[model samples]
Target chain A: MTDRVIRLQEAPFDYGAECAAFAERAGGAGAVVTFLGLVRNDGGSLTRMEIDHYPGMTEAAIDAIAAEAATRFRLDSLLVLHRTGPMQPGEPIMMVATASRHRAEAFAAAEFLMDYLKSRAPFWKKEHRAEGPIWVAARDADEEALDRWAGGAG
Target chain B: MRVLYFAWVRERIGRPWEDVETTAATPAALADELAAREERYAAAFADRRALRVAVDQRLVDFDAPLEGAREVAFFPPMTGG
Candidate 1:
């Protein structure tokens, strides 16, 4: 079984440090790919952002998604770290890394994880703008991305 | 069952979580029951298309049976990444 590090934490994490640690722990994997998501200022309109996540479901959903990625990609391992609660502009929101024997598989797995996390996970983002706060709407494009994976076309 | 709300659902409902007692057999039915209670609930659940539901941490259809279920969460489509 591949190793999986799925963390749904409120504290901010160092992206560089987490990536370095994940790669090192990949253990002979030929490739490691990482993706990081940051809170954008939205042209100075965003004051900050609040991430409200279901405490129980967040962990359960991410674990299931990571497991699916590992199986489908024949992955060596993966890392999923996401933040919750209030966050300032430019702060790191989340990161996912995938390790595999081939770069293609690693990259594919990372993308798959991100697509699922965008809609499947239980975290909701409320963007606090200077004018007011608004809940970020789920894009139809995101849900559509999962369709490609289900088609087995990668 | 324990009913949970998140995001704008929570904001509209004015609570994050609450204990709810209902004889409704499905999430859709439970929604109707709650919506009948208050205008806030009616507004929150006005459009079922904009919402999602989970039972015991797993996503399920609104018509999914709630027999023996312990937890139900209702929220808008997730914007997580």
Candidate 2:
């Protein structure tokens, strides 16, 4: 059975603690990989970032993504944690962790989760700049990243 | 059905969600009905290519059937990471 943990919260998360707990729970897995996304100030004028998400849909979308990753990669465990609401530039926005019996499977699952989170999840971001707040546009690169995994084996 | 909006779409439409009663059979038909209601919706949905739709929390094409769908959400491409 594949273990899964998914969380969407407004408060900050403890990355180190979460990692340690996940490692403990994933016991005996040969490989574990973790990816963390941080808010970036592309224009150097970004003062804050705000995330808006559909309350009922966000968790459902992430759960479906995690389930797909587990089946495709034969993962032993998977964890996805994302933050919403106002945040600073240096704060952690999200994290994905995966465990598998092999390094390749673990790495691939983590990347897959990240790609889905970037484009498929129902979350929107707005950057609060020194001048004004602007909604961030979805990038073609992110879409391409997700498309690469389509109809492919783990 | 309940129609929901997010991001810039919500800003432009001036609300988060609304309850609508329509005879539309598909998301595209519903879009047409909403667009005809007011100018703000027309402008928000002016470019179908720029918007994405979800029926019952699953992403689908505009032509996807909305039969028995309790919720329909329209928003721009997701920018989550």
Candidate 3:
């Protein structure tokens, strides 16, 4: 069985602490890879970002993705953490960590997790700018990123 | 069944969730039924291409069967990261 840690929270997470803890728990895994996503200010107009999610479905969707990544990569461990609710620009929005015996597997799995989370997870983001709030649209590039993993590109 | 809306859909509908009694056999049928009930529902679901659906908390197509489904959700495409 693959060990997985998944959490969906409204509070901010400490990236450094979470990385250390994940690496420690991964134990004998020779390689660990982590990714962090932060809210960005576009044209310095973004004041804050509001995230909305289906309470139960969001967790289920993320768990399914993490489990798939673990199996595909033969990972020793995996962690996925995402935050919902209002957040300021520059604040950390989410993180994913993967561990495996080889660096290649760890890196690929982390990227895969990110690609799936970006487009598949049941989370919606709205940017509150100086003018008004607007819901962010799903990017076609994200769907293309996910497709690469299926065609042996990743 | 409980019908839930989120993000702009929720904003457009002016509520988060509602219980509906319907004979619709599929999500598309259900959407049509709801759309006929009110202008808000029609507006929220006007563009099918902009919306995504889930049956019983799992994402599914509009043509997905609603048999034994207790919940259905409608929202815009996910923009998570």
Tens-place lDDT per residue, model 1, B1-81, is 999999999999999999999888999999999899999999999999999999998999999999999999999999999
- Docking category of candidate 2: medium
Which tens-of-lDDT digit does each residue in A34-151 have in candidate 2? 8888899886999999999988889889988888887888889999999999999888999999999999999999998888898889999999999998999999998889777986
* Total backbone collisions for each predicted model: 0, 0, 0
- By DockQ: ranked, best first: 2, 1, 3
lDDT of 2: 0.91
**lDDT (CA) per prediction:** 0.92, 0.91, 0.92
The digit string of per-residue lDDT tens for model 1 on A92-111 reads 99999999999999999999
Native-vs-model 1 lDDT?
0.92
The candidates' interface RMSDs, in order, read 2.8, 2.6, 2.8
User: Model 2: number of clashes?
Assistant: 0
Tens-digit per-residue lDDT, A85-130, candidate 3? 9999999999999999999999999999999998889999999999
Number of the top-ranking candidate, with lDDT as the measure: 3
Off-target runs (Cα >4 Å) in candidate 1 are A151-154
Ordered by TM-score, highest first, the candidates read: 1, 3, 2
- TM for chain B in all models? 0.98, 0.98, 0.98
What are the per-model DockQ values? 0.70, 0.71, 0.68
